[model samples]
Each structure stands twice: as C-alpha cells, then as structure tokens.
Target: MEIIKTAIDGVVIIKPRIFTDSRGYFFESFSQREFDEKVRPIQFVQDNESKSSYGVMRGLHYQKMPYTQSKLVRCVRGRVLDVAVDIRRGSPTFGRHVAAELSEDNHLQLFIPRGFAHGFAVLSDEAVFQYKCDNFYEPQSEGGIQLIDDTLGIDWRIPTDHAILSEKDIKRTKLADTPLDFDYNEDLYKK
Candidate 1:
C-alpha cells in the first residue's frame, strides 16, 4: 500500500496494491501490522458500512472532544465524492477541505483524523461505503457544519437538482457560527 499526504498534516489518501487478471482481482483491504507500520498507531474498534443511492449527500459532521473519531474510509461499490475538512482553529489549513473521487475502480481509502468533518456525495447508481473508526459513536457529542457553507465551496460533482440531503444537514450552522474547541496544531496529531 502507498500513502499520499494531503496538504494538511495527518490526513492521507491510501492506495492499496491490486492484483487484477482476466478473471477478477484480489487485494488485502486491511492488515493490522501493515496498517500500524504505514499509518499512525491506531486500533480500529468498529467497522461500519452504508449503502446510498445517487445524489445522496451526507456529512460535514464530527464529534466533540472526548468523543472525537479517527477514520479510515473506502468505497466498495459504485462511487462518491468524498470530503474531509479541518476544523482545528490554529492549524494552517483550518476550514480547508480535501476532496477525492472514491470508487470501486480506484480502490482508494481515505484517512481522516479526529477534529475533521467528513462527508460524501454519491456519484453512482448506488454505493457501499465502509469505514473503520477508532472511537465509538456518541450521539450527544455529534455536531455538523453546513455542507454548502460558502467559505468552503465544495463541488459535489453532481447537479444541484439531483442532490438530496437530510434535515439535520439542512439545519446545520455555517462554519463561522459553529462552536469549536480544537486548535489546528492541537495535541491530537502529535507524533
């Protein structure tokens, strides 16, 4: 596997080695030892999967302190415009986002550390998205910023009329109005 660093520190794009033939293909999605060596030391406690249809947009969401999560995400079927945004106040790339096309074709995985908001828009007929998280879900600590906040204009790569969003997302606050507790250079990403 090869890991590519994004503009922001600790955020990474992972490309796994794929073996393809006239018949099919094979690849090890995850290996504890290899992962520990390649990425930061993390012990993923939960694996979650979601299937969504075209035009479905989810996120710009994260959990507050004491419940923040680090994730390794990938698409197993179809495609999506995956996104991660830094919310660490003192960080150089605060409010900046990294967007990538994730699909079954490319077999890429994204590593989004704690203090980042993650979201995705389905670009295919349907998609099965999987992610491993280091922390468990905490409903009370959940928070979200508006996906269409003008400060961070993300092109979901889908027509506006085709886009579908949840009620919670529609009611989310703009980045400016959302309260944050993280500094960009906080202890979270220390080596």
Candidate 2:
C-alpha cells in the first residue's frame, strides 16, 4: 500500500497495490500492521456505507469532543470528488482543505483525520461509498460547515444550481461561524 500525504498534516490518500490475472484483480483493503506502519494507529470501531447518484453532495460534517472520529473513505462503485476540510481553530491549516478523486477504477482511498469536516460529491451516474471510522456515531455531537461556503471555494464537481443537498445542509454555517472546539497538530496523534 502507498500512503500519500496531503498538504494538510493528517490528511492522506492511500493506494493499495493491485494484482491482476486472467480472472480479475485483488488487493488488501485494510491491514492493521500496514496501517500501524504507513499511517496512524486508529482502532476503527464502526463501518458505514452510502449510495448516491450524480450531483449528490453529502457533507462537510464532523462530531464534537467525545464523539470525534477519524475516517478512512473509499468508493466501491462509480466515482466521486472526496473532500476534507480543516476546522481546527488556531492551527496553521485551519479552514484549509484537500480534494481528491476516488473511484472503482482507481480503487483509492482517502483518510480524513479527526478535527476535520468531510464530504463528497458523486461524479458519475451513481456511486457506492464505504468508510470506516475510529469512533462510533453520536448524533448529539454532530457538527458541520456548509459544503458550499464560498470561503472554502470547493467546487463540488457538480453545478451549484443542480447539486442535491439535505435540508440540514442548506442551513449549515461557514467554517468561521461553526461551533468548533478542536485544533490540529501532528503531535496530537504522536502521543
């Protein structure tokens, strides 16, 4: 597996080695030992999956304090423009973001660490997305920033006029106005 770092400290893109034969291809999607060596040691406790059609924009979402989660995300079918934004106040990359393409063809994955907001927009006719989180879901601790905030300038890979969003997303605040209490630092995970 190849672990590629993003501009923001903890954001990483993972590319697993694929072996192909006459039948097809095979790869190891996750391995604890490899993870401990190539990435941070996250004890994933939950898994989630979602299916969406083109133009569907799902997030810029995170959890607060006790329920904070770091995630490893991937696309199992079709494609998408996956994104992560730093919401850690007082950090060098605060409000910064990294965007990458994940698809069935490439079979790549993105790791968005804790203290960040994550979301994705479908770039194909449809996509089946899957992810693993180091923590469990806690609806009461949910928090998010508007996916369309102009300050972040993320082009959801779909037209704003036609993009699909939930009612909750429509009222989300910008990063600057969100109630964030986390901060980013490489050493935060080192310890």
Candidate 3:
C-alpha cells in the first residue's frame, strides 16, 4: 500500500495494491500489521457501511470528545467524493479540508483521524461505502457542520442544486457556529 499525505496533518490517502487478470481482481482491504506500521496504531472496533445513489451527500459529521473516532473509509463499489475537514481547535490547518475520489477501480482508502468531520457525495449511480471506526457510535455525541458552509468553500463536484441531503443534515449549523470540544495536541497525531 502507498500512503499519500494531505495538506492537513493526520489525514492520509491509501492506495492498496491490486492484483488483477481475467479471473478478476483481489486486494487486501485491511491488514492490521500494515496499518499499524503505516498509519498510527489504531484498534478498529466497529465497521459501518452505507449505500447511496448519485447526488446523495451525507455528512460534515463528527463525534464529540470521549467518543471521537478515527476512520478508515473506502468505496467498495461505484464511486464517491470523500472529504475530511480538520476540526481540531488551534491546529494549523483548522477548517481546511482534503478530498479524494474513491472507487472500486482505484482501490483507494482514506484515513481520517479523530478531530475531523467526514462526509461524502455519491458520484456514481450507486455507491457502497464502508468504514472501520476506532470507536462505537454514540448518538448523543453526534455533531455536524452544515455541508455547504460557505466559509469552507467545498465543491462537492455535484452541483449544489442537484444534491440531496437529509433534513437533519440540511439543518446543521455552520462551522463557526458549531461548538467543538477538541484541541489539537501535536503528540496525539504526529504519526
């Protein structure tokens, strides 16, 4: 696997090696040993999956402290425009975001560390998105920033008018208005 660093610290893009032929393709989706050596040492306890159609967008979401999660996300089928936004207070790249195109063809995975908000937009007819999280879901700890927060200037690739979002997601507050409990600690994410 190859690791690609983003502008923001602690966020990385992984390109896994795929072996293909007439028989089809194969790749190691996750190997704990390789992950521990490349990315930081993280114990993923839960795995989640979501299926969405074109123009569907979800997120700009994160969990509050104590329940904050680090995720290894990928598009197992079809394609998506995955995004991660730094929400760590006092970090040099606070409010900045990194985006990558993940698809079954590319076999790319994105590693989003704790203290970042994550979301994705389906770019294909249908997308099967999967992720491994270091923490379990906590409904009460859920928090989100508006998907189209003007300050962030994100181009979802899909036209804004064409995007479909849930009522809860559409009602999310702007980043500046949202209350966050994370403070950037260099030691915690230096890896």
Candidate 4:
C-alpha cells in the first residue's frame, strides 16, 4: 500500500497494490503491521458499514472529547466523495478539508484522525461504505457541522435540491457556531 499525505496533517489517502488475472483481482485491504509502521499505531475497536444511494450526504460529524474517534474509510461497492474537515480550535488548518474519491476500481482508503469531522456523498447509483473506528460510538458525544456551511467551501457534487440528508444532519450547526473542544497541541494519539 502507498500512503499519500494530504494537505492537512495526519490525514492520508492509501492506495493498495492490486494484482489482476483472468480469474479476478486480489489485494490486501488491511495489514496491522504495515499500518502501524507507516501510519500511527492505533487499534480500531469497531467496524461500521452503510449503504446509500446517489446524492445521499451523510455528515461532517465527530465525537467530542473522551469519545472522539479516528476513522479509516473506504467505499467497496460504488463511488463516493469522502471528506474530512479539521475542526480543532487552534490548528492552522482548522475548518479546512480534504476530499477524495473512493470507489471499487480505485480501492483507495482515507484516514481521518480524531480532531476532524468526517462525511461522504454518494456519486454512483448506490454505494457501500465501510469504516474502522478507533473508539466505540457514544451517541451523547456526537457532534457535527452543517454540510452546507459556506465558510467551509465544500463542493458535495450534488445539487442543493437533489441532495438528501437526515433531520439530524440538517439541524447541525455551522463550524463557527459549533463548540469545539479539541486542542491542536494535545496529542490525540496518546492512550
């Protein structure tokens, strides 16, 4: 796998080396040793999967403090525009984001560290997305920034009228209005 660093610190895009033959294609999706050596050493405690159709936008969400999470995400069935936004209060890249296209053909994965907000928009007719989280989810700790916040300058690819969203996501506050607790100086990887 080749790890490509993004503009934001600690965020990365991983490309797997795939082998193809007349039979089919094969690749190592995850390897603990290589991940530990290449990226930061962390243990993902939970795995989650979701299926969505075109124009469905899921988030710009995060978990606050004690329950904050780092995620490794990929789209296994179709295509999606995956995004990660830096939300730490004092970081240089705060409010900035990195967007990458993940699909079955590319086999690319995006790693979003704890202090950022994560989300995705389905670009194909249907998409099956999976993610490994370093922490178990806590509903009470859930927080999010409105996906349509103009200040963030996100291009979700779906027209405003065509985009679909849940009531929860629709009610999320803008980045500036959302209260953030992450400190850039804090080592989020510390156990």
| lDDT for each residue of candidate 4 in 78-184, tens digit (9 for 90 to 100) | 99999999998889999999999999999999999999999999999999999999999999999999999999999999999889999999999999899999999
What is the Å distance of residue 30 in model 2 from its true position? 0.5
Q: Residue 111 deviation, candidate 1, in Å?
A: 0.3
Off by over 4 Å in 1: 189-191
Model 2, span 94-144: residue lDDT tens: 888999999999999999988889999999999999999988999999999
- Where is model 3 poorest over a 10-residue stretch in terms of lDDT? 182-191
Alpha-carbon RMSD, candidate 1: 1.6
lDDT of each candidate versus the true structure: 0.91, 0.90, 0.92, 0.96
lDDT of 3 by residue, 43-125 (tens): 99999999999999999899987888999999999999999999988998999999999999998999999999999999999
Q: Best candidate per lDDT, number? A: 4
lDDT of candidate 4 at residue 35, scale 0 to 100: 93
**How many clashing pairs per prediction, in order?**
2, 0, 0, 0
Prediction 2 TM-score vs. true: 0.96
- C-alpha root-mean-square deviation, each candidate: 1.6, 1.7, 1.9, 0.6
TM-score of each: 0.96, 0.96, 0.96, 0.99
User: What stretches of model 3 exceed 4 Å from their correct place?
Assistant: 186-191
Clashing pairs in 3: none
Q: Estimate the lDDT of model 1.
A: 0.91
Stretch of 10 with least lDDT, candidate 4: 182-191
